[model samples]
Target chain A: MKLSKEEIAHLAKLARLDLPEEKLEKITKDFGSILEYVGRIQKVDIQGIEPFTMPAKSEGWRPDEAFEVDEATRELILANFPERAGDLLAAPGVFETPKK
Target chain B: MKPLNEITIAEARKLLDEGVATSKELTQACLTQIQSLDGALHAFLEVYADDALAAADQSDQRRTDGNVLSKLDGIPVAIKDNMLLQGKACTAGSKILQGHIAAYNSTAVRKLMEAGAVILGRTNMDEFAMGSSTEHSAYGPTKHPRDPERVPGGSSGGSAVAVAANMCLGALGSDTGGSIRQPASMCGIFGLKPTYGRVSRYGLMAMASSLDQIGPMTKCVEDAAIILDTIQGQDPSDQTTSDTEPFRISKLESRSSNDLKGLKIGLPKQAWQAGGIESRVLENTKAALAELEKAGAEMVEIDLPYADEALAVYYILMPCEVSANLARFDGMRYGLRKQGLPLFETYAQSRAEGFGDEVMRRILLGTFALSSGYIDAYYVCAKKVQALIRQAYERAFNEVDLIVTPTCPATAFRLGEKLNDPLAMYLEDVFTVSVNVAGVPAISMPCQEDGGMPVGLQLIGKWFDEATVLSAAKVLESELAKQ
Candidate 1:
């Protein structure tokens, strides 16, 4: 249940959250209490019980058919992008540019 | 005629059918009430006044043409901001999606629209439905109509308040954990969390996907039944939706007429007492059980031994899902996008700025729980405990047709009281979470008043068996009304 600041930062990294240095102290303290609460799971009797996501069917498999989105709707979704070109969204480059 | 805003959906239908009242009059009355009271209540994030009036007028036109959609036709309703209304802002009460508009109608909202229910507006909620109190809303907290100093328990606080204060006759609310039921309890109205997969989640913003359900918050059990009838069914948009026969309000009434004879309601020995429930709340719950017994229902003492651990299981499993579901808010396509030269920085910075404190805390908790080193101890263990809890309920249902418990351990608490401590706030849902965890339908209805504040009695039924739950609640509701 003891969550050190280092662990909090590591979690922030994994979560893709830009946590500042100051937020770490409070978050770590929170993690301690929250972890303490859920720590009861460790004591739960699970000798033969399976790890279940839901009591009923949690998800369903849909056919991989091409569902259609009209042009107007597609335009609206593209419009929400931070960097937009004509009918397209610009995602930041995943690979570095080659040096000439 | 009675004040337009005071009429229930059934009453409005009767009056409108008799040409005694117009949908415009009812819709206008609600708008006037909102104009007058919403400044103090903060229940609505945005009100669709003009659009609602137009819809109401259209309903009037259709009715004049001798055509009607359903009982909900021409009635004004509110929607939790989390449920999408296409072209309306679906904030989920967070800055993360400050200007994000819903591209298409959520299945529930679309159903309501098709039913000719004039959606008044989007009500406030906890940011991404994270907190127990509406105080976590980035927009602002929704005040209790009964006591301005107290919170209208949330994240469906606005919808509850909307119905309580007559801003809308009924509203749709989504429950993940106890969001809908607890708020309904606080507001002294009827709220139902249908069995998971009973209602489609096509457009309702995801909280904990496995545990979440869209349901109705209304002034009466019958209205809850009517709304549920309209919105519950299979949909191609959501695969989890079942072909369970849609719940029938008439069947519920007919069942209630059987007068509760031989009906068994159970009280779990291991639920709702561990943290010392308030004396008044416990007394009200016991009194309600006795009242049901007086009306010919058999009340039995039962045990959901694993329910004592439901909270721990919920906190673990829910956040793990949250960590995964909320990971989509990375400033890439929609919602709050911040710029850093690289894509990674944009995601982190956007989320860091967009999410509120409670949301961040949960995301962190979820991330930590799902982390490789901690997964077995936290997430996996919680899931096993969840299965155990479900099994306990299954066994209990085999013995009893329904279960009864306090909707909340206490009435509505003051707004700022538990904000400082996260765990204290999470405990507000102790009584209601297990029902969601079990994937069963449960409802909260006002059983009594404690010092002028409402105490809610929760009726839980077998998975997908909302009829028994509503019927049993109707028996208790009429009993309370008679008194």
Candidate 2:
């Protein structure tokens, strides 16, 4: 499938990447070749074959038991926040407020 | 005697046990090598001099008190930056995770620590393990150990360089589409990618969960076996890890038969094609095969009809997983953050600034592939084709005990040679990706040197059969060394 500039931009939006305009053309061209190369998979006659995501035999299943991590481990995880408030990780507000 | 750093793990173990060399001396030798060459090679992102030496001394103390943990006790090794080491910085070579400290040890690293293996440092890699060349690493590309001008193939390039240059005796590298094996081939070292689910992925920064498997890069096959034995096992945290049988090192010890008595090696018709492959690579691989044949192994010509499509399937599936796996880097928890007024913009801006060009391209490619109208054509089709490829390998294995091919089509290219061409970079993994796609174990070892560069011969083993793969690799390793 041919990916247009608009298509690439839409893809960037979907992927949460704000790509620069100058690199757009090059990326579009690069994607064209890559897509063309990867497009070969479309020719495979997968009439009855189920899509295999991963092997069925290698599954490691465990009981659904929840346990609290050690205090030291808990502290280590909390300490990695780029923007933090005491113990919670901070982030931009997700919702817009209604007009008053 | 050889430089202490250049000694193999087996040699170092002997010295340590015989009271000839102390662990401190070996660790110091590695640190000295890193200090001397890593500035030019860029192999290690950070060298843990104090920690490594301290660990070494502790191991020595244990040995003195008759409490050595395992055969790996006091051994110095490196870990690819993607694997966490508890409190150490784990960027996975991406600027996104800069200043990020791992809260807990990765299962592999934890195992290494438990075995008393001294961790030298975290080596550099492709950012988010996206690129074939380590050039995509945010820090800088690691230079080839032998030639500074060429690449040491990647995304495990730095680990390969570290092992190749003797900065570390062995290293842990994660392979998602040949990240470990290709670099090992390029650097002229032994690299193994254990069968999928053979190793736990508890703390490895996920690039493609289904395809990623952590393995060892080392000076010898025995060392690869040692590291794999220590690291491979089912872990409670990783549901994908299976309770596979151990990679019994004892099986590799008995080398009574000089000939591969009943071993059947398959040469796939697609891989042996001369057009895409370099002349020297073809020659060396053919020569290596001839040696195996002379040693009485049956050489069977096998057909893998879907072999050519493995790369296509990998590119599609890998990015789809990458886009999902890397979504956690939204500037909220831990990593580089760029503030924008709206929340959506914040996520976009932070990622856009944090990731490199290739990463962004893959993310977008993944988004497009899995996006509305195109999902059936790209994602589903690739997955179905992946099944076909897997079946082809399964059928081939019925006829042959193992499959063999050149690890890479060509020696490591000059830096920037294929850097600008994304498709060209992907082609370097053409031979190696199929093993990952099939989820089988494979090893790449130095077969011959093309001019000054080392050419790798790869052996593909059946599912959960790393023993045969390593055994074949050992035979090839010794056979090639004869020349």
Q: What are the DockQ scores of the candidates, in order?
A: 0.56, 0.59
Residue by residue across B354-376, what tens digits does model 1's lDDT show? 99988988888899888888898
- lDDT value for candidate 2? 0.90
Each model's backbone clash number: 0, 0
TM-score for all predictions? 0.97, 0.97
Interface RMSD of each: 3.3, 3.2
Q: Spell out the clash pairs found in candidate 2.
A: none
lDDT of 1 by residue, A1-100 (tens): 7989998998998898888888988888877887887797788779988887533443547567987888877766776677787777777676643232
C-alpha DockQ for predicted model 1: 0.56
For B1-483, candidate 2 gives per-residue lDDT tens digits of 999999999999999999999999999999999999999999999989999999999999999999989989999999999999887889999999888889989999999999999999999999988877799999999999888999999999999999999999999999999999999988999999999999999999999999999999999998999999999998877878887677798888775435687999999889887368988778777888888887778998889787768999999999988888889988888888876457887788899999999998888888888888888898888888888998999999999999999999998899999988999999999999989999999999887655578888899999999988988778767777788
Query: Over 4 Å off in model 2, which ranges?
Result: A55-65, A96-100, B255-257, B449-451
